[model samples]
Target: MSQIFENLPVKVAELPELTPTDLQPIDKRYLKVLLIMQSIIFTLLTIGGAAIVYFSPDIEPTLLHFAYACAPTLVLWGLSAALTLKGFKKKKYALRERDLLYTKGLIWSVRTSIPFNRIQHAEVKQGPLDRIFKLHSIKIYTAGGSQSDLSIPGLPEETALRIKEFVLGKTAEDGAIE
Candidate 1:
């Protein structure tokens, strides 16, 4: 058994270096929407926390309790705001010869490249918040999973539609469309 393993050749696949492309950034309006949504959520949580602490008979209404309630919310708000700004700058997408690349992240960056032939289908989606701002996201499906192969959010409605059509066109060309 040991001799059989020793005779086998080892092969390691490595990803190639990414070439820079004219990546399109999502609309600036998305930033405002994100900030507003985050603010509302954090504000509601802060209020709820304060109310709970104030009503607890066992917990004295001390400065510590007050600070505990406010400090976390404030800190989270600051961190989230910073991350949102940083992430907005990092979010961009580009179409290559036979693949599409979507790059996003603040701390741990992710760059996904999905080949045209691998794309099973593409769709445009909008939530209430997205509709309020006329923004949309694209979901690209592939063969391996139920979840989307890629979901690029914060795109303008027209841009999202364009991308969807482009991906579908490519799929049809490659004879991959069902």
Candidate 2:
């Protein structure tokens, strides 16, 4: 058992080794904004929970005490979101000719590989919300439902199209690098 634990590989650091990487660089502001939104949500829930404890004198005799106990969930929720954002910032992605690799998620960090040849269709999409945020999403449709559509988000519009074209074998005036 100790030998098995010793053989486990060390984790890679998050800083980019080169100027370009396959993964979209999310603005750190996104994580910050998300943290704020989460905090607001927990604040609202905590307030509501306290109100229940104050107003419901009947249930307070029994089950309501547990409800009041759940008030601490607000702090737990906020801390959970904060920790998740930290984990997300530590992830990275790489695009290769044969396949694309991405790492995402919180405690259960996932590393997914989608082969380029298996990509059936691709598109560069931007909605009203995305446009407002100056962000773009590139969707790559693969062979199966498991990894069917790869949505690479928080990219610039031009970069999204370039990735779309690269997958489609459609090059721009500047060629593949553009």
Separate clash counts for every candidate: 0, 0
Question: What's each prediction's TM-score?
Answer: 0.82, 0.60
How well does candidate 1 score on lDDT at residue 171? 76
Q: Give each prediction's root-mean-square deviation over alpha carbons.
A: 5.9, 8.6
lDDT of 2 by residue, 1-178 (tens): 2354555474334323333455644554445445655777787777777667668766663565756656587669967887867775755656655565666777787867666766777878876556666767777777667445676665677766777777676322222342
Per-residue lDDT, model 2, residue 40, is: 73
Candidate 2 has an lDDT of 0.64
Measured by lDDT, the strongest candidate is 1
Q: Give the residue spans of candidate 1 off by over 4 A.
A: 1-19, 62-64, 146-148, 176-178
Clashing pairs in 2: none
lDDT of 1 by residue, 1-178 (tens): 3354554464222334456656878888888888989999999988888887899898788989988877899899989998998889888888776788889898899988888888888999997888999999899888876754888888888899998999899878876545
> What is the Cα-based TM-score of model 1?
0.82
Error of 2 at 72 (Å): 2.9
